[model samples]
Target: MKTTCKSLLLYVLIASVAVNAFDPFTATFVVGVGAALGRWIYEYSQEKCDSKWIAFNATGLETDLERRLFGQHIASRIILKAVTGFMKNDNPKKPLVLSLHGWTGTGKNFVSQMIAENIYKEGMESSFVHVFTSELHFPHPSQLETYKTQLQQWVKGNVTNCAQSMFIFDEMDKMHPGLIDSIKPYLDYYDKLDGVSYRKAIFIFLSNAGGESITQTALDFWSAGRDREEIELRDLEVALSLSVFNNKKSGLWHTSLIDKNLVDFFVPFLPLEHKHVVLCALAEMEAKGLQRNLDVADRVARDLVYFPKPERVFSVKGCKTIDSKLDYYT
Candidate 1:
């Protein structure tokens, strides 16, 4: 009885001290910390439960991809089909892979930006849309192993978080050997692993490997007085694929993505002519909220150098330098 009374007295004393020590300031601090912690927990739960899959506006995207993306009808069509198919597919065995071969300034990067904008909720800034540049990301040949490990981890981590992801690889022709092959596992036909499925993802490769042949083909058509549109997918697909495969300098060379036919599409970006540059300039002007000025566009187009020496057939840099050249005209 005496020991029990002493224990009760000790409990009462501790309770009194706690109450006294908790002043108004202490109470407010405690409440503030608790509220902050609660908010943090709630936000974390929301993020975890949130669905990263963004709903694509098919009709709107198709129109924008076609309209905003100038001069590449074949590429636009293939991109549309791939995006639509992947989004609608309930079961996919492998990821949609595309090899975009063209010279610089043919809108390869622009098309990629368009895809991200339409497909991803956050657009190019989305965590799901990852862009890897050979020159920027992995330039050294010795870094191939490191790059492979990093690439695999990145793919696995993102797919685990969200199945719908887009990966754009730029300067593929400058990439180190075996680096491009690192993604074969994620791209190949496979079942889900650890609840992660990469089949819903998209992979785009941009390269200038076959720029010479593409330019030659375009020039040949111009010389023959044939319409540029006369050069179709059939005329370039096989040749471009072969050129990328055969060239040792190409990133796709010796990579099974091309040899094993894992690449879903080989979309060639044709060289932009004077007319396309003018269109680009006009588009730029419009984007700046300025009225359509054909005179300014013509002047911009004239300022750019053209090829075939004497004939001065086409815009040498395509629409690559049009944006900067427009500043002077404006």
Candidate 2:
């Protein structure tokens, strides 16, 4: 009877040990599943956050410009927010510099990633200078009218009682001629025309408009009814005799038909000193191998730093234009 009882006790102990041994395997399986699920959730959350940030920050950038210029930079959205803050503020007057990129480039290319990165590092809410770019495609006549109306509404809504704003229109040559007329209302009112002190806005129109048709138009403006041959000859002479920074060379005089009643056209040529600074900046960028093309290097450099010494003179013998400067830098 005693022996039988002891055997039974041993059997029960063995069964208990076997049950305990399986607990570790069960626990390990549960832990593995939990870890995997946690990792997947964290990754998904991060991706969602990044997408939201990008969309929130790039509110006003033209889609094409954003895709082409800021596609690589991670901090573009941040820089844009800083710029928007500056635009909204009314205190401590600062010029609103608008950069218009030429054909085949986005504003981001002209502004450069380095510059945008630097702007982001400065932190948001700090009052930095403001710069904007109208990199959207040239609008049709109807589109231009629509844009004008929308812009007017925006100003009325956001900039109440504001006295002045600076405006820059880049690639003016690419825009429909009628669009130019649509903007006249803004310019005229800002300049305090008709004895009213509305706003003080300085308008800058930058374009490559010295082509045959443009030149002929200038000739026609001066003297109508001339043969195409005579107009072409006069246009050629006018184009050649005009100073490098002259309106004729820069194609700013085309605004006469659009806004003749407004202030006399003011097309300040970028100074030679500024040109040299641009060249030096490009050279520095090239030394760093940021870009291979001289034009690209110069543009990137300008985006990084404005002409530090606007008064420092540089010769124009070989660096006659921005294009020439780009060639030398390259």
Candidate 3:
């Protein structure tokens, strides 16, 4: 009984000391120290942990893009499957898929993310997948040769021998023909080095050249004292039929790079159809409070519809329609 009373007295004294030590500065310091310690522990644990944030899940994404593009989900699934297959086989001998985007579209970021997410959904990590993006910019005359040399080095280092890598070129139209020529050797290297036993890596080049340019030309022609509606419809049809990239030398129109015969897959952008799908997707994201700069989409859509009068069309509030219900058209 005496020992128990002594223990109670000791606890009461400690509690009294703690309660008396109530200086604001001391409390703040204690809290700050605790917060710092907690942060340090969390960071340490994260560094030591092997788990990663999964960016894509097939089951989850099925509902995502499906609400955006109805039947195109089939194509998206195929793309996801193809990339996953490439990841599963450790053999670098698999064919790589190159997805190219048209002018104003950042194919590298968008397509690469989509592909990356799809691969991740299949339980693959970003480090295990190789997605390369080549952006062709018109370099200054003085820096052209140096840039070329650096580009060659980069290709050799990152892209040369990888058996399964996707090379995506954003804004194919902006890519100078000379720049495309420069990369021809790398594509050839991949092709020649790939044996028949190696899984074929696929290349996909997507472009919107045909639709945008044709629509612009038609709008220019129709702007001169002609029936606007008829001209608009005609321009739309022409834009729809316009090829993404036209071979200036051969008169053959293609949406993707043509100098390299090794490119196995070419995807042309159907302006009206592709634009509609993308816009709908953007609208859905916007509705969900996902931030996106719709200005780019607006500009691209206007360029497709009233090529010559893009500025005028954009200025009109109701002229450009996003969805069947959301009209940006003035």
Task: State every prediction's TM-score relative to the real structure.
Answer: 0.83, 0.33, 0.46
Q: Rank the candidates by TM-score, best first.
A: 1, 3, 2
The digit string of per-residue lDDT tens for model 1 on 1-330 reads 346545555655455456546988876665565556556554543423134436676786798776777777777888888778776787887998888888888888988888778777677878788899987889778777998998889888988877887889999888886787887878888887666778888899999888888778877878888988788877776678678998887788898887678898888888877778889999999988989899999899888888776877766677898878888778
**Candidate 2 lDDT, 193-265, residue by residue in tens:** 3433334333444454433333334335335554332333333434432422244333334554333445332
* Cα-based lDDT for every prediction: 0.79, 0.38, 0.42
| Per-residue lDDT value at 101 in model 1 | 84
lDDT of 2: 0.38
Best model per TM-score: 1
User: lDDT tens string, model 3, 1-330?
Assistant: 346545555654454456547787776665565556556555643412122433335544454445433323223454555555545555644355443322332122344555545534332244334333334344354565666676556545443344333344444444444554554455543435333222433344444345345335434544564533233323343343335334431112442335444443332221223345346546544765656656645554454433224334211211224443233321
Model 1 per-residue lDDT at 32: 61
* Candidate 2 TM-score to native: 0.33
**In model 2, which regions exceed 4 Å deviation?**
1-142, 155-161, 189-197, 211-278, 281-330
